[model samples]
Target: MDIQEKARPPAEVYDAQFVPALFAQWGQVVCAEASVREGDRILDVACGTGALTLAAADIAGPSGSVVGLDVNPEMLAVARRKPAQIEWLEGAAEALPFPDNSFDAVVSQFGFMFFEDKPKALAEMMRVLKPKGGLAVAVCDAVENSPGYGAFALLLDRLFGKEAGNAFRAPFSLGEAGQLTAICREAGLSHAEVVRRNGKVRFKSIDALVSTERACAWTLGGVLNDEQFERLLNESLSVLEPFTVDSGAVEFGMASLIIKARKV
Candidate 1:
């Protein structure tokens, strides 16, 4: 399946299965860095399922405004159901529908790597922000730094060759701190700060993790045949064995970079 097709999973599956497992913690971290105030206006660009958007809304309080914008209508659909107060809009990062200098802060979590025109998108993000507005973005680190993901990539390469591996690696494309900061500078965002942090990724069991991967539209979903899927599950069990704790649950360290900047 193509990248677009892979990204079009049902909203419920994504929210129920993927959010708690991988996105919730990062959402909190990104929102905290945004430094939203009681009356601030915040925009979450590419806010998948409104994870970060919801967190921002709590900080923004009753008088403040928080808008969750996404290119996918399905994601917006799910986001709208969460908080009745926050506005959910269907839009792309490259061309924000809001007026210039409309928001006091902008934040994105694990979404920048997927933008087709990142420079244009960054420019648009800055254009919508008030002067001195903060911008916080979080992206996964390189696959090598993430052992579990590294193993998965190696397995995909062994099974389906380079294309499959590349697809798996797309999320980590902007892994380097220097590269991310440079991109922000090129897009006219000044004094960008990039920090690397470790987050814990956990799964109740190996089967649970494998199930999520198979169901995730952006991962190996629909790519593996029944037999290949079975083989992948069995093979991955061995690979993840080391990360499994005495309680039978699996946990691993995940490294990610948080890039903070201001529209000076």
Candidate 2:
């Protein structure tokens, strides 16, 4: 399957497995960093299953308006089940459907890296924000900096191929702070600041981590046969043993870069 197809997982799996494990904390951080106010109009671009969108809606309150836009209909379908107060729209980040200067804040959590046209997406985000409005984005750092994901990618490469491994690496492709800042500037969002922070990646167990990856992670589900998946589970448990804590949960350090900017 193509990368796009691989990236699309069952909405149920995404909401149940991926969101709580990873995206939820980043959602809170991104919305807070973006300064989503009680009555501010907010836009969440590439909002996968509304992790950030829901957070923004809660922060924006009833007086404020929040819209969650994504190119994936399945993702939007999942998000639509959330608070009716938040408008969930289907659209691409490269060409947002909204009019210019329509939002007080635009925030994306772990979504900017997947846009096919980074510059155009940045431009659209800039175009939608009110003057001096904030934009915040969080993206994963290098795979090397995330030991769990690094090991996962290496195992995928060994088991599948480089193509399969690329799915894991793609999210971290734009991890560099300089690259992120340059993109914002190139898209006319000058004065962008990129901050790197360390975060913890935790899972109840090695099996839980592998199951979540197979269910929600890109290019993982449907690629491995039953036997292969079992082997992978065993291998992952072995690989993650060093990171297992006293409670038998796997916890590892992962770094992320949060890019903050404002329209001039």
Q: Of the candidates shown, which would achieve the greatest TM-score relative to the real structure?
A: 1
C-alpha positional error of residue 20 in candidate 1 after TM-score superposition, expressed in Å: 0.4
Off by over 4 Å in 1: 1-9
Point out the worst 10-residue segment of candidate 2 by lDDT: 1-10
Top-lDDT candidate index: 2
Candidate 2, residue 228: CA error in Å? Answer: 2.0
TM-scores, each model vs. reference: 0.91, 0.90
For candidate 2, the clash count comes to 0
Which residue pairs come into collision in candidate 1? none
Compared with the true structure, all predictions reach lDDT values of 0.81, 0.82
Instruction: Flag clash pairs in model 2.
Output: none
Q: How high a TM-score does candidate 1 get?
A: 0.91
